[model samples]
Target: MRKGRDSKCLGSIIFVLVFCFAISALPFASAIQRQKAKIEKHEFGELADGIALYTLTNRNGLEVQISNYGGAVVSVKTPDRAGRMADIVLGYDQPQSYADDTVFFGVLVGRYANRIAKGKFSLKGVEYQLAQNNPPNHLHGGVRGFNKVIWHPREVSRADGAALELSYVSKDGEEGYPGNLSVKVTYILTNANELRIEYSATTDKETIVNLTNHSYFNLAGAGSGSILQHVLRINASRFTPIDKTSIPTGELKMVKGTPFDFTRPTVIGSRIDQADEQLRFGKGYDHNFVLNKKGKELSFAAEVYEPKSGRVLEMWTTEPGVQLYTGNFLDNVHGKAGKFYNKRDAFCLEAQHFPDSPNKPSFPSPVLEPNQRYMQTTVYKFTVRGAGRGR
Candidate 1:
């Protein structure tokens, strides 16, 4: 009877041990289940006109929060080397603050991504005037650009990823731009950890269009700290310098021997404060780099590395220029997690035509005539330093 009792006790102990192992494996199982590609739509509150906000998440854990109002990228969550995920873009946690967002955050910039000299541009022999939102010049579309309006979103699921296609029709004379512009922008989150932005537009009349995503990224995680130590590399040997009012001076200045040089990998803060005239004008590295392109195709534009987290971001685009704005204007602004964001907290790489291109005849024309299509593609690919397949 004692031997029989001993056998029963040994069976009970084995059962307990097996149960504990299964319990410990629950979290891992759940994570594995999440790795399958899927898209989820969450109710992200409403805009003034009852437009809804939505967030899309993929199976690989790439999450993109967006609002129909302005088609803004509210946030982007990506994983670092340790497989720990964090929001790497700067913005407000609550969607309401975005209604009056002045810094642009992750909004879609357009009609023109940069500035227009003195809010004036002559197109097709007609001088057009725009709102001087940036004081001496017209900045980012106008006083009420695409960032300040709602869009119609059509959700689509692809074989490898999911996409949110946002459409908007801007009536002629809106924001002083002459065109009934119908624009379609698709934001795709792929299983390969890529955030792809595809823009297309057609105008009923001749008009200028330069679209880009204004996302301030900090690979160390948003609002965690400054991105001063982030290593940056751009494939451009030339950059467009800005004047006192932050408008491009229409000259493609060589970046060699200047603080603007990023041809070789360099820390962002290494020469940011150097006694250079261009650096002083932008308060940092706020200039448009002329992308080196061999043909009219997508090519490597820039790469940023955060050593602390081993997070690396590679930008590929078909556009000819990329505006590198080093968060120079962010100051004392409250962001996600109740964190205060200051200057140099993040950086933006906006892929588009050169700034003030409408005024600079020598620059690539941003004009779209009747029956002509405007299309631009930009991809932000994320990876860890030692990730074999570039994530």
Candidate 2:
């Protein structure tokens, strides 16, 4: 009878062990399903009425909500290593804050994105003067850029999953930028776990044009902490060194033996504190990297890998250069949940023609003439690998 009782006890132990394993597997399975769930898009308002919200969700259940107002990315929901969702891009949850924000959060900067030195550049024997919003230089479309004005929506469909097309028209002499430029920006959330932003524009007169979305990203989830620990990899052998005023000094320097070397992946804070002139000039890293990629077409520019959350952001763009800004001037702005955004709270990877390109004859020209289409596309794809498999 004792032997019989021993065998029964052994069987019960095995049954309990198998049950525990099965229970553990259930959470994993549920996580994957939640990540791959259907995406939903909801309309916030009419296109003619001003701004609207459109959300694109992924199969792994990542959702990116945007507004046609400034082609702004309102919120981005991605899964952490534990399958928990958090918004990683910095922006206001309310429309009022976005409408009255200090800096450009998630705006479609254009006509010219970055600054042009002294707010003037001679193009083809004609000198054109631009608005000097950034003191001695012009910045991000000059006061009334694509962000401040409301844009009309061209196409949007719930059937497209999470894709929408938004367009804007800038009249002549607006903000000192020449030409009546017509612009279009399309955002797509793909099943491959990527958010692609494609831009196209055409002008009626000769004018300088460079368009880019100003989206601040925080891989450890937005408002989590400083981005010093995130590993970064930029596909470039050289970078465009900047002057004290953050303007390109017309010098294309190699990244060999410098703190700017990102050929191999390294943490952002690895050399950010180095007492170098370039770092000091930027107050951090606000310089543009002249991509090693030959020809003026689409190429991979940079990548951000957050270890704790296992979230990766890969940036691919058709522009010739990519600027890496470490968010040095966030200025303790209070965001959602009263979270104060201090320095290094977010980072921006803006792809475009070199800054102050019009002034530097050695750099690529950003001028677009009549009958010519000015086109630039940049795609930011998010993928969660490692321990974050859907969950």
Candidate 3:
């Protein structure tokens, strides 16, 4: 009887311990589940044809919505210091709205990312003339650039996070260019809260190519208000000054005493309204800063911090220059969620070769040879201030 009682006691103890262990593991399992990345696709309405919108969610609940219509980053939802999630990119509610968007919102710019000087450039003694969409200069490819077209998208399997790959082919003479350029842009939302954009291209003939994403960001949340309060820092000692026509003067001017200086963290509105020539010409900041790079490798380009939200954005790029556009021409444009985006409502940090590189021999070359491949990588990492520091 004594032996039987002891055995029963042991069995009861083992059962109780197992139950407790299982209960204790529940929260851990839940956490692991939460860390799993996911992607969802939905129809984003018709624009000449059916457009698909993909939402990629990272491990930490960060979500990015992209549309195939223009490979536009429709929305980027991230958590603030208080753990409240909000969309941080400006965009329209419908795909058709993007068709008429002039501010470039969050689209993939290509062919030649920035201006091309009176829509003309000579390559190998052959001069090509493109559409002059922006008056004397040809801006963002042409009238019908990559940002206005559809792209083939496929979901890529990635261990770190969710990825979406978009491919497009710009035929020879499509935008008055001389080559059939095949381009691929991959957007990966890694578990570490980074949105990595990888761009690769191949051409059948020698041509100039500079591609970049023009995403107007308001770290305080899209449509919240102006971005003047945001602090910005650009890793650049010199910037390419622009002429009255918004073309780079081919002079790499120092940023030390100019309103363009952003070597250290400074409020965007501090000197933006100063009576400066560059500011007046652009109506605000709209020039490219010659990035301080040691080599042709990815390096820190810029950082933006929003104090109210305690959200910080760090940009790393392989490109030699970054355009710091302050949305000077926003003009009370209607945006997502019935919001109106005014001038200086947001900013764009476009990582690419200097503008009009093909026309300016002194600038870094944007040419891509037939036998060579063009590749560029840019990462936008997001984090809250004082995160994980027991703040």
Candidate 4:
């Protein structure tokens, strides 16, 4: 007809300008997914008793603040080596200064983080007692553990450029420990200056788990006291000796000439003044080593180094065991900006699962049956090796 009706009117104006540019980008992609879910619900945190607090910022300015009470972290502002940041993980700033503590500084341990000796355990055939609160041995989750209850904050995402995630749920027996676990802990802050912790959990019945995170670092800040000239390292060749009430005596031994030979990188006051007998049975290096890497993956257990705030940190874990401790009965307690916390002044690697390992049947067996799903993941990271420069 008229040149095929002008080529069908230019194909209907290029299909109506591509359907009006895809309906004008559908409200800019639903307003960028509702502004990323309102900046991830404004990074949560708004509660009192069942505590809550999640704040994460990165791009190297690294600022992490977690607190679901015992999901504890409370504060960590990495940088050092002159990059300057201050607070490196210790607690007690408010919220009644962690209400009432025992020895777990920056909380979030768990139903079975470490130690379960006399508190009893007999799974399948049924025989649980728990709640002994150490001494008769029940530690970690007994004395109302989970770093002392209170966790319910969930969802805080930003996961990159400086991560942010805080989650919790512990029903199924609450303190008596039996399941319904559901945990999630993420705290990234990359760009190299590190500060990462990632853990996830799941349970339903046949319990007996081990989760960790007892903070208490002191990269030359938090209470500013003894880390005994730092410098640690713990790839572990084997260690699981404890007694005098610190439990674990199933003996996995051999850390070469004891004092738990940190394989290579030493100097936490060089053998912590070696009076060896396992440093007087852990009045110094608490115990648990083992992490020569196996099974689940994750890798690289410990590595400290403060040297006057050149920071470092470096942990990493899929959990097989890593509990260096060194705060050695920290006394005077008075952290967070008010400072004070004397004694060894701060230290805790705690990547965990070897204190009691549920009465050690040749160790390594945290149980977790009924549908089987008890995971672990740890990462300390934090950086600055020389001339700081974090921002």
Best by TM-score: 3
lDDT at position 145, candidate 2: 80
**Residues 263-307 of candidate 2: C-alpha lDDT, one tens digit per residue:** 898999999999999999989999899997877678899989888
Residues 121-227, model 1: lDDT tens digits? 88769999999998898999998899888788888777767788899999999999999999999988887888888899999999999999899999999888789
Q: Considering only N, C-alpha and C atoms within 3 Å, which residue pairs clash in candidate 2?
A: 35-59, 35-60, 35-61, 36-59, 36-60, 83-391
lDDT (CA) for every model shown?
A: 0.87, 0.83, 0.93, 0.75
lDDT (0-100) at residue 359 of candidate 3? 85
Q: Which candidate should be chosen as best, given lDDT against the real structure?
A: 3
Off by over 4 Å in 2: 1-49, 157-161, 387-391
Two-way lDDT contest, 1 vs 3, winner: 3
TM-score of each: 0.89, 0.86, 0.92, 0.32
Off by over 4 Å in 4: 1-60, 63-78, 84-121, 126-161, 164-185, 190-200, 213-228, 231-267, 280-307, 310-322, 325-348, 351-354, 360-391
> Which scores better on lDDT, 2 or 3?
3
What ordering of candidates by lDDT runs from best to worst?
3, 1, 2, 4
RMSD of every candidate to native, in Å, equals 7.2, 6.1, 5.5, 21.5
Question: Lowest summed-lDDT stretch of 10 residues in model 2?
Answer: 37-46
Q: Stretches of candidate 3 above 4 Å error? A: 1-29, 387-391
lDDT of 3 by residue, 55-101 (tens): 99987789999998889999999989998999999998898999998
